[model samples]
Target: MTDAAPQGRLRARSLGVAAGALPTGPLNAITDVDGVLVGHATVDDGADLHTGVTAVVPPRLGLPAAVHTGNGYGKLVGSTQVDELGVLESPIVLTATLSVFRAADAVLTYLMRLRPDGLSFNPLVGETNDGFLSDIRRRPITEQHVLDALEGACGGLPAEGCVGAGTGTTALGYKAGIGTSSRRLVADGAPVTVGALVQANFGGVLTVQGTPMPVEEVLPGVRHEEPPGNSCMIVVATDARLDARRLGRLARRAIFAMGRVGASYAHGSGDYAIAFTTAPPQRPPLPDDRLDPVFAAVMDAVEESLLNSLFTATTTTGVHGHTSHAVPYDRLPIRPGTGG
Candidate 1:
């Protein structure tokens, strides 16, 4: 039980907000990357259950994808293939830790229906522990839930905070959840959009663009460590064409952005980021020098995406009456009460 947030959901640049130089797309979300779709299945039994699944669908199956292990410390299934082959065959699913295997199974089942005659497939899955507000032992997620997310996926600015895999998640002692942001860049005279989506469930002194928030002051007596060695699942999407090797380089920048927003990268934290693009080769081969603008866009978008997760999240009560309070918008340096 915490005081109501003074303002409604808003991104960092809403009220006199200025964090990045590049302009954002119309939606300012991962879906800003054409053909990239996102969907969520939130489970809120109106009781202790507050977990769900989030599915991200690329333009097509088997696209270039890569992951950067910022702090390898949790269950990330199908990562080895993505590391070795540098491609993804199935949609990416995000869920609770224990449900990762089940989520992957659900993905495979769906893929078989799409291609029954195929022999091999890889389902990219990532997770963040949401035990703070949900009974993790119950493993509330189901294959149908996974399927629903995938089937319902669509291209647009995704719903953020306290939905999808971010439900029941805690970050920087606040009730953090799903968030997204995007940046537009002109690469080789073509408009390139770099968008970021985040499951904000990790810890540290919460910072927004280098300014830290007084968590204890805003949410007095809030527990700073209930979630226990939490993790974050960050997904970056762009229209810039790059293979796995280059994608890996772009993926690491998302982690750097996480740090700027106050991720401690704890010993038990499983901080991971995956980067992909829907762009096709417009020329024989693109040089590495052209990636500089894309990298800068990724960094800013990821940073703002994390802050959006925190700002949009409202106070949530959970298992055993343990409440994860939302970060007070008034505590932020920028003026509140506006939307992006």
Candidate 2:
């Protein structure tokens, strides 16, 4: 979390924000984790296509990584290999449900071109169906879109709310999009940073810091609706030395933030979390006992990031004139004086 604000984008911290005891890094974004970069390719082609791609490009490929499935209902490409082998060979990508295979192939193209000699790697692509607001069957995402996100990926505040893969997403009956937050921490005398980024496309009662904001009450004309099987894709990054096993545990803690924010984790919701460490491969892994601080940081950062998604988004109208209203700023029960 840098002293420089996200230009003018509103975040949870903007309104005198505090999610937990730990302090946030300068950027207060997932980019606070050294070497972790983010980029988005938003597609808005008139009425039919209102979806795109988001890429979380790590400094190096094949970093020690792991994925934890909060619910087993997603089209997460290349997850099994990472689960079995415990390493991520590709950048993490998020997109609409039908575009997953295309996203995977695009990454493969990016890799083979980069490693012309020879390359064997599994591309991790996570997806959430955005049919309610977009024409998903077209699967409009293309290789160019993935490459654009990857090539342009840089370290800084990632544009959130109704952008990239979140362009057509709806969460808790409100318009939801990309959201991010990070924490600065010390473990065993070693300084570490933990950050979370999410594609919040799921459902639940809207709650911020234990205070509830039912959809009907906040969005004047919006009706209460819970579409089954929607999803959320969570990415957790840390500079702490950790192995794939420990990363799995950390990933689970990241998903727990969904519950804290009132996520349904419903049967149709494909809730998944993937985590990685940018610590050099040669460094010793952090002790398990020292991980309590890391867990708290993850939960706090993730909860706030989800809130950021809702706060930053604008009301959107997509396919067939279907609309998803943004969570109104005036109506939110924000800690007085903290909201923008």
Candidate 3:
């Protein structure tokens, strides 16, 4: 995993003991969720348009899974079947709102090309608005871009800030993009892995741990502002054994962690979370079979992943020349006696 800071002048420092005592996974990323792969298709043409696509492949083999939860505020295609059947037989694609159709088509093409054996393809694709930073009207995300992301999928620490679909994204009026974090949990004397990856585009009055700290409190010239349309699509994955029902519960708990970070679920913000478990499948008539241990790990991973999203994001600038500042490390009120 790369310890190097993001590729921008406004990058923040490392976690620096500010993340409490929770032990992060080897890569401190969603990729640590075994067999998971992440890829990016960032478009930086120097035309003041910074936007792209990102794909998260739960397993290269396209394991059968489930969504288990749904949100009306955002666009999550191919989730209906996922919720009804408790299986997600495809990769999850993330891209700007306007490019959803193109992304979906591209994903279909990629899958078809991969398995040219006449097998049907139904992909899960999520979106958040990036019109403020990119020429969304032009729909710059081409079929080629989608294919590139799929072909480039690999395991390791994912690049953060100004990369992938998060390139022009913002959070709490600050520049934000794709951020990830993970955690390991113990249940029934067994360890499990849970992880989260987020495409952050929301904005609001910045706060930390319930304390209302506006941007001005931390950085001069930084104002308390909101994006034209703010939203976030968070994806959580776990290797612990969990049924679809338990996975839904775990996904809902992620919203609580979002609240802890000071998000009130803004009116225009399409805040949504999708969670899944890679535990071995159970036979029919056993919905609750072997799920307790996995639930515990899901909760632990969701909490840590939310924190990582915030930490990994760096300041960014986008279309219309809007700029969001990075969170200042020195301004963080690290608790005493805690080695942050």
Candidate 4:
């Protein structure tokens, strides 16, 4: 909950950023976006068996917003209205792939039980595949877990790596889980905030900046065999003034950042990005407004967020006796320009 003085170089467990180039907002996290809160429900039991849920709530005081990006590589429940009509009427939820149905149902139940005024609630939920370590087939996630994540949500520094839904995930052949980053942008003479949160379950060879360093290089004897059917669900939130169409374009740019970090969108990997804007609601009859500045902010934030996720993740062990090592802080290649 504290904003440590900005460092000359910010070094995360797995990734590092140049010290003074890009300005990091307070907390340097998705929560930097005002009113955005993140919470995790982690379930870890000794070795291997680990699972949990994460929740991202945008302004608990019922702020109206809209979702624009609608990719199909993975499942994002409650995006239909966001895409069709350009509005998000609920908090966004994230959990394991198999738990989407239960999570969504639980969210609905919470909303109705709390409101009780016949108000409709469309909950946003994103998922990533984590079957390699956990018994995904068993559907271990329950409705209560979803509720716990929701109820426990708060604003502050989010706990990363081996926590929540990221507990059993892997990224680029190494242990990976939830990663988040944020950036501040000034467009059209006003300051705007954009933030990104990711469920790191994608498969790729480890690479930094464009250096192709396969997982085997760092973790000797490891083979590039087919990874578990894994996928990543990235949720981006911003307060910039942008319409749904512009937001969709910004969401697509997140893939570019993913690729920069060495993800290939493999046939078995499900890579998806969902972006929304909490800019004041422009209800019916409101005059159309231009959103070029918001689009630019989205692109900048998505790129930085992806990098943060990779840097924050630490090595982890999961079910089936598989262990993914963390990126070696000493061995990573650092160029003169980019932070080492």
Candidate 5:
């Protein structure tokens, strides 16, 4: 696993900031789960365009999947079919709010070419409003952007902070973007991995390790371009033997952990979590009693992943010269063992 600081920024863990007691996978990323692949297509024109597409590709087709909505104010395409049929047919695509349908169509186009004989396909797509830093009305994302993300899918540590679907995102009064983390644990006598990737674009006080970050006190009149609430899209992947029902339960916990980082879940915030398992049980599934560890792992991974998003993101100036500053560690008190 390479260092989590991909863009000359520090990851939360690098500052000794973390959540929960569970150990992380080698890369501490969603790709830590074997066979899971992630890819991104960044459309930064250094002008009005600051949005892009992100793809989360599972190991195989027809995997058991589920969706949990914390607050359903934003668009999450293909969710009804995923909930009704309990399966994800195509790679999960994420982009700007207005670009969701186009991104879904791109996913459909990508899948149709592969399964030429198949009649119908359900493409999972989710989005958050990036209007503050992006000219969202322009709908800059293209079919090629979504397709490139799908085709460029790879394993290993994925990029984070101000990239892909997170390119124009803001959170907790600061710049935020794609972030990921994974946990390793044993369930029902079998080892399993649970990984999470988050697009942090919501609003709230920034909290870590039970302490609220003093964004106002430190920044002293920082730009608050976005409204009170926006949205956050979470994708949770695991190798545990869980079906749609179990995955739905898992998805709920991922959303619940948003409070760990002070997510408002405001009226307009669209908070959704999607959970899927790469390995469905061959024999009888692990009983419900064995799911406690996995549940704890999800909460921990989600909390840390959100923090990673903020810590690794740099100050960004977007459309109209509106700026969202990075977490000012130099002025703020956030450290390994103290409040920030």
Candidate 6:
């Protein structure tokens, strides 16, 4: 429900830095998709902890969903079920790497409490290592934090950078966190919306629309110590009526978009993307021939979301006095009106 960026921080688009030419939805956020809600529960203790939970809620459970794993280097609870049966019975949750299990359990608890009659449930939970800036060993994410995030889910522009599961995360040698973007297009004369939310914690040679970012030269003395093998979690939502099979294709496009942002997919990176649709089940699936726009939208939204995560994040000092500096505007090679 919270959509406020950190004080004095601006998103990638605000800085005239954009990823694609596709038009964004009204909020330019994942929540722009009708019936999709997002919320965050940040647990910043101000001393050693910088971790939390992010919840993405759909209109209902048992929705058609699919997941694509770019690299299976990290844990993703309930991914097998989603990949096999193509059913998402619970809201998707993202959190710190070490606390994924606790976050998953909390999600089950919340869903069970909401629908006591449901016997079997599959809770999808994803994570990225935040140990660089958080006391990951403490496992600070409690069940209450998950509950708060799930209960507070709302339909609006969600906050970006240094919040929710993105807290303490660093990407591409820069401090990064939660970011979201959406694309609006017309397919077969009917409007369709595709939205994406990303927890960017991986590393690579940063790029903006094919232009490489010279971090060392631009931001002198800023530490880029986070390894190239962290992770990234992407959740995509749409209002298009699509089946699980086609949704899987859409999910893969989301991961492929990572390359657009220069994701390394290193040995230890666990890159995954999950796509789900909110269109009513009674609606017929959109034919595959008309899916080009949808796929393009997914790629653009994912790319933009990654940039927003880094651009909006602020520098932070965490456990063991480790610091992750934010990617400043001056570091980028592209700017407004100059044409990247």
In model 1, which regions exceed 4 Å deviation? 1-8, 281-285, 337-340
- lDDT against the true structure, each candidate: 0.84, 0.86, 0.69, 0.67, 0.88, 0.88
Clashes of each: 0, 10, 6, 5, 1, 0
lDDT of 3: 0.69
lDDT tens per residue, model 6, 18-54: 7678888888899999989998999998779998999
Query: Is candidate 3 or 5 superior in TM-score?
Result: 5
**Regions more than 4 Å wrong, model 2:** 1-9
Tens digit of lDDT per residue, candidate 3, span 1-340? 3344456322122443223244557777789888888999999775567789998887744444555332357788888877777676678889988888889999999888878995677878988887776767878999999899988988898887678988777776566778777767665455677787888887665554445656776677665557666788888887766666766777776655565556657777777777776666662322454555444445445544444455566655666666667766556554323432
Clashing pairs in 2: 1-25, 1-26, 1-27, 1-28, 2-26, 2-27, 15-338, 15-339, 16-338, 229-268
> Which lDDT tens digits does candidate 1 get at residues 258-293?
888888789878999998878774533246888888
Q: In model 5, what is the error at residue 216, expressed in angstroms?
A: 1.1
List where candidate 4 sits over 4 angstroms from the true fold.
1-15, 18-21, 60-71, 282-297, 335-340
lDDT of model number 4: 0.67
Candidate 1: residue 290 Cα off by (Å): 2.0
RMSD of each: 3.5, 1.8, 3.3, 4.0, 2.0, 2.2
lDDT tens digits by residue: candidate 2, 230-268:
899999999999999999999999888898888988889
Model 6 score (lDDT) = 0.88
